[model samples]
Target: MRVRLSPAALLTIFGNCVKIKSVNSIFDFFSWLAMAILLITAIPQIVLNYKRGSTEGASWLTFGMLFFGMTVLAIRSWFVTTDIIILLNYNLGAVIVLIANMQFVYYRIKK
Candidate 1:
């Protein structure tokens, strides 16, 4: 016996093989991993700032630029995915950079 398949039928078959939710979940997992890694990268700078009791040699301009960039990325991520990981990654990243900027100001004034 011979069988003929329509485009809709092929789509249905392929669709069953690959699910949108599963693909999104995979991306979400990676997003969470990336978020964790990126967040960790900021910690060393924060700790160094705290331990040293100042942010000398660190340019406030750098952190200021980072804050603005992160804030914009966070907003864009919210609109793009609204996924918790994406939201936290960008928003928390922005907050961290903002704190770094504050550290610069606080320490500069302290000196």
Candidate 2:
């Protein structure tokens, strides 16, 4: 038995599928891009602290609050699902913040 399909129907299905995939691809790209940018954003602070040999504007309260929040968020992401990108980025950010926090403590004591 042979069945005939209309060209318009096929075109419509193909077009919708392509549209959905494109949107998904765009979203995935931006999500991971933001993750990468956030992961690296902490480096400058560390560098500045190194160059200055002290932590000036970087407040302990700010660092503590940010790290705590990030840690909580990462934990939540872990419990909810295994999103490696989210887990890695948030944890890395927390670690970087910890490094900065330690530099502050050390430099303050030295000064």
lDDT of residue 101 for candidate 1: 83
- Clashes (backbone N, CA, C under 3 Å), per candidate, total 0, 0
lDDT of 2 by residue, 1-111 (tens): 998779999999899999999997897687568556655666787898899888887778877787787778677777875868667766776777778778878998999
Which residue runs of candidate 2 sit more than 4 Å off their true CA positions?
1-41
How accurate locally, in lDDT, is each candidate?
Answer: 0.81, 0.78
Candidate 2 structure lDDT: 0.78
Give candidate 1 misplaced runs (Cα > 4 Å): 1-34
Q: Looking at candidate 1, what is the lDDT of residue 35?
A: 62
Model 1 — TM-score against the truth?
0.63
